[model samples]
Target: MGLKYKYESTSRRDTKELARNVRPGDRLYVIHDVSQVVAPLEDAQLYSEFIVTKDKAPFTGTPMVCSASAHRQVGGTSVTSLLVRYGEVYTERPVGIRNIAEEPPLLPEFQHLAARVAREHAADVAVARSEAASSGRRRWF
Candidate 1:
């Protein structure tokens, strides 16, 4: 058994409704384009597919669009559904899919947090060393 879901087309409300109430034997691949295709009852597997296009403005240094990094839980013996959860911007360069290291810095005072962290870590090490010296050397049993 698996978790059932509600999916949607970013442009259409009717297709969104279709996704929410889809049956086990439903052909959901291109429901966004043609919203009324049903699956053959004889067929045990179901099919669904979705695409999320997020294009950013052009850049000079690095290519931004890294991964459409998606999972294909879709299979022949199983039902397939693709729900595109993206930035939803149509552009020449798709800006979707980013890693955690690519995240922008926090706002305002927290922007310099990395430097502060390094300083704090240095202070902690110094404090630990001083305490150890004062406590005297330990003799291993």
Candidate 2:
């Protein structure tokens, strides 16, 4: 099973209520797969020129907005309710794209990177064992 970190929405809807309702250790499945139509960024020309011209752009590089909806699952199958976690909110204008990379890092990606390193180490050990077996040498582990 794939593991994912939970992100709570700042919306004042019932989903936020559910998050608040759940007790610590209560099993909760986060369902995040709903598509809402958003305006394409490529079609946005009003602020594009300024962003391209300015050295220190204030706006987010993404022209298209994304509407992210979240849901809570009580059991393995049932969706308890829906909530709006992230709306298509725009960032401050005129900001450069580089600024996004400079922002604080996400914890989930860091954990994933560490896990990948561990898997690589394990694979290396397995390869060494296979080589030792073929060469008539005892494997040291």
Instruction: Name the best candidate (by lDDT).
Output: 1
Best by TM-score: 1
Q: Clash pairs of candidate 2?
A: 41-63, 41-64, 57-94, 57-95, 58-93, 58-94, 58-95, 59-93, 59-94, 59-95
Score each candidate by Cα lDDT.
0.35, 0.35
- The alpha-carbon root-mean-square deviation between model 2 and the true structure, to one decimal in Å, is 19.9
lDDT of 1: 0.35
**Superposed model 2: Cα runs more than 4 Å off:** 1-106
By summed lDDT, which 10 consecutive residues of candidate 2 come out lowest? 48-57
* Candidate 1 deviant stretches above 4 angstroms: 1-79, 84-93, 96-101, 133-141
Per-structure clash totals for the candidates: 5, 10
TM-score for each prediction? 0.27, 0.24
TM-score of 2: 0.24
Count of backbone collisions within predicted model 1: 5
